[model samples]
Target: MYCLNVLFASQLNHKSILKLIRCCLETQIPILVFESIEYETLADRNHRPSHPCFKPLLFTNRLKIAVEIANAIAYLHFRFAKPILFRIIKPWNILIDKQNIVKLFDFSLSVSIPKGETHIKDVGRGTMGFVAPEYVTTRGCFNEKCDVFCFDVLLFVLLTGQEITDYLRCEKGNKFYLVYDVKKYFVNNRVK
Candidate 1:
C-alpha cells in the first residue's frame, strides 16, 4: 500500500507541478501520479525575499520546516517495508503549504533497496551542489546515508537564504563545491 497525504493550501496563487509515487510495502511497483497543487517551493520561500510573492520565513518556522522534512524522510526510509532512498533532497523539490507544513514531492528519483541488500548502485542524478560527493565518486552507490548528506546541505541553504551552487559559483568563480566549502567553515570554527 502506498502511504499518501493530500494537502490543500488555503491561499496560494501559483500552481506547482508535483509528482507523487505510490509503492508497495514489500515490492517496488513504481507508480507515478501527477498532481497540481497551489503552493510555493521551499527554494522560492527561502531565497526569494525581494520578490513580490515572497513570504518571510521566520527563524522558528525554519526549524519547524527542517523537522518536518526530517519526518517525511524518516517515513520514506524506515516506515516502508522496502526502504526508499530519496536521491534528490533539494529545496526545489520541497513544497510548503499555506500552513507552513512541508510537503515532500517528486519521488521520481527515489529508489528502494532490495529486500536483502544494504545499498544499491546506480548512475548519479541530482542537482550539482546538493548531490553528495561520495555518492558521485562511487558512481551512485548509495543507501539512506546519501539522503542525510543532502539534507544537511539543505539545512545550509535554509540558514543562509541562498542556494549552495549559486552562491559558491558567484563567489569562487571556478570551483564551487558545497561540501568542500562547508568544510572550510568547520575547519575555521566559523559556524556559529
Candidate 2:
C-alpha cells in the first residue's frame, strides 16, 4: 500500500464536467471519489436503432448535448493559461445527467500543452474508430486538433449510433487496427 501526504486538486468548476470529491491511493489500485449524479454514459444510450431497448432522443436534444460537450472541450483547450487535452474523448467518457446535461470525464490520457510547443507526441491512446490518423502515422505527434478529430467522430456516432463508414478494422490481440489506406488521406485534411 502507498500513502500520500499531499493531495492533488484540480481547479475545474465547470457544469459540464464531473467533480472529483477525493482521491485515495492507500491500496494497490487508486480509488477516486466523485460527486454522484443521476446519469448514464453516452455509450449506453447510443445503442443500435434496431435494438428493442433503443429509445430515440430528440434531434434538438442531441444537438444541445453536442454543443454542451463542444463548449466544455473548448473551455479546456483555450480558457486556461495552459491548454489541457482530453485525449480519450469518447462516448463512454461522456455522461448524460437526468436533466439532460452533458458531463465530460476521464482524464487518464489527457495532458497539458507545454508553453512554446505547438505539438506533442503521445502514445496513440485513443479509441479505434475515432483516433486521428495523423496522430498515429506521425508516431503520436499531434495537437489540439486531435481532439477536434475525436469530436467529429463522436458527433457522427451521436447522430448515427454506429461507427463511421470507409474505415476497415481487424482485431489483433483484442486491439482493433484500421486497414484502409490511412496514409493516402493524410496528405489532405480528410483523415486528420
Candidate 3:
C-alpha cells in the first residue's frame, strides 16, 4: 500500500519489499502509506519526541515485538535468495499499525549481498551509534555480525530507555565528550 519514492531510488528493491510486505500481510499486519512529504517533514522536525501513542502497547508486547523483529530480520538475511543487509535497524525504522503487528520499513540503506561476498563496501554507512566497532575502525569487512551489534544497541535502548549513544560516549574517546561528562555528573550525583 506504500508508494515508491519517485526521486530517490529505493535501497530496497520491489521484490524485497514486496516479499516482506506479503509476509507481513499474511500475518495480518496492515501496511498503509501517509503523505510522504508531510511524513518526512514531521519526522525531521522532531525525530525522538516521546509520544504515548505506542507506549502501552510497547510495554505490554515487548516480547512479541522482539520475536517478530528478530524473525523478520532472520528471514530477510537467511531465507531470501540473497541476503539483504538492512544497514539501518533503528526503532524509527519499525512501524506498528493499528493491530500492533510489527512491519519493518525504511530500507534506505539496504544492500543485497551475493553468496560469496564477505563485505559489502570498504566504507561504513548507517547511523553512527548503531554502527559496528570493526566497521568504524577498519572501514570495511562487516557481515551479519554488524547487524547483530546494531540489534543489540536497539535492544539496549528498548530495555533501558537510555540512548546507546549516551552510553557509548561515557566510555571515553567518543566524540561527545561534554555531553558524556554532563551525563556522568548526573549519574554520579544520583548515586551519591
Candidate 4:
C-alpha cells in the first residue's frame, strides 16, 4: 500500500496535479493534497444554471462525469489494499477541472471495511436524500452496495437535471419530492 501510494504521488507530481500521502500517525490517516487550481464544484455548476460563467453540461459531458465518479469509487473499493466505502456521494463533493475532468473529493465520511469483514455497522452518515434505504433501516450496516445505491441516485440527478429533493409547488403551496413524483409516474404508467 505504501509503495502504491508513493507511485501514485510521483505520477501525479509529474503532472503537478495531485499528491497522495499515507502518514503513519497515531491514527494512521491518509491525506490527499491536491494542487491549488481554479476549479468549479459540481454542485455550484449544476445549481447555477443561469450564472454568467455557467456552461451547460452536454449529455456526453454528464456521462463522462458519471463514468469518472464510478472509476474513482471502483479504485477505492477494488484497487486499494483495504476496500473503502464512500458513505457520501454528492455533487458538492465533486469538482470539475478546466479540462472538464471530474474529481471526487472529500473522504471524511469514507470508511474502510476491516479485513475479513464484509460490512461495517455504525451510525448512518451522509446527505439525507443520497443515503441508501438499507443503510438507514439497518442503522448504518452497510457495504459497497450502499455506495452503489447512492451512485445510482446521483446518476438520476445527473440525467434528469433535477435535485433529489425537488419540490412541486401546488396551488396551496404544498410540495412533493421529485423522487416520489418519479415513482408515482412509473407506478401509474405515466412515464411512457
Task: Give model 2's TM-score versus the native structure.
Answer: 0.76
- Candidate ranking under TM-score, highest first, comes to 1, 2, 4, 3
Give the poorly placed runs of model 3, Cα more than 4 Å off. 1-54, 57-60, 169-192
Query: What's the CA RMSD of model 2 in angstroms?
Result: 5.8
Which is better, 3 or 4, measured by TM-score? 4
Cand. 1 Cα-lDDT: 0.72
Task: Evaluate residue 123 in candidate 4 and report its C-alpha lDDT on the 0 to 100 scale.
Answer: 83
TM-score of each: 0.77, 0.76, 0.61, 0.74
**Residue 64, candidate 3: C-alpha displacement in angstroms:** 1.6
- TM-score for model 4? 0.74
* lDDT score for candidate 3 against the true structure: 0.55
lDDT per residue, candidate 1, 159-190, as tens digits?
76777757766756756577777898789987
Using TM-score as the measure, name the better of candidate 2 and candidate 3. Answer: 2
Positional deviation of residue 19's Cα in model 2 after best superposition, in angstroms: 1.0
**Reference-based lDDT, residue 111, model 1:** 73
Over 58-169, each residue of candidate 4 has an lDDT whose tens digit, in order, gives 7788888888888777777786677877677888888887577776765556667889999999884787677777887789798999899888878777766776655234
Worst 10 residues of 1 by lDDT: 6-15
Q: What local lDDT score does residue 188 receive in model 3, on the 0 to 100 scale?
A: 82
lDDT of each: 0.72, 0.71, 0.55, 0.69
Runs in model 2 deviating more than 4 A are 1-9, 48-54, 164-192
lDDT of 2: 0.71
**Residue runs of model 4 more than 4 Å from their true location after superposition:** 1-32, 167-192
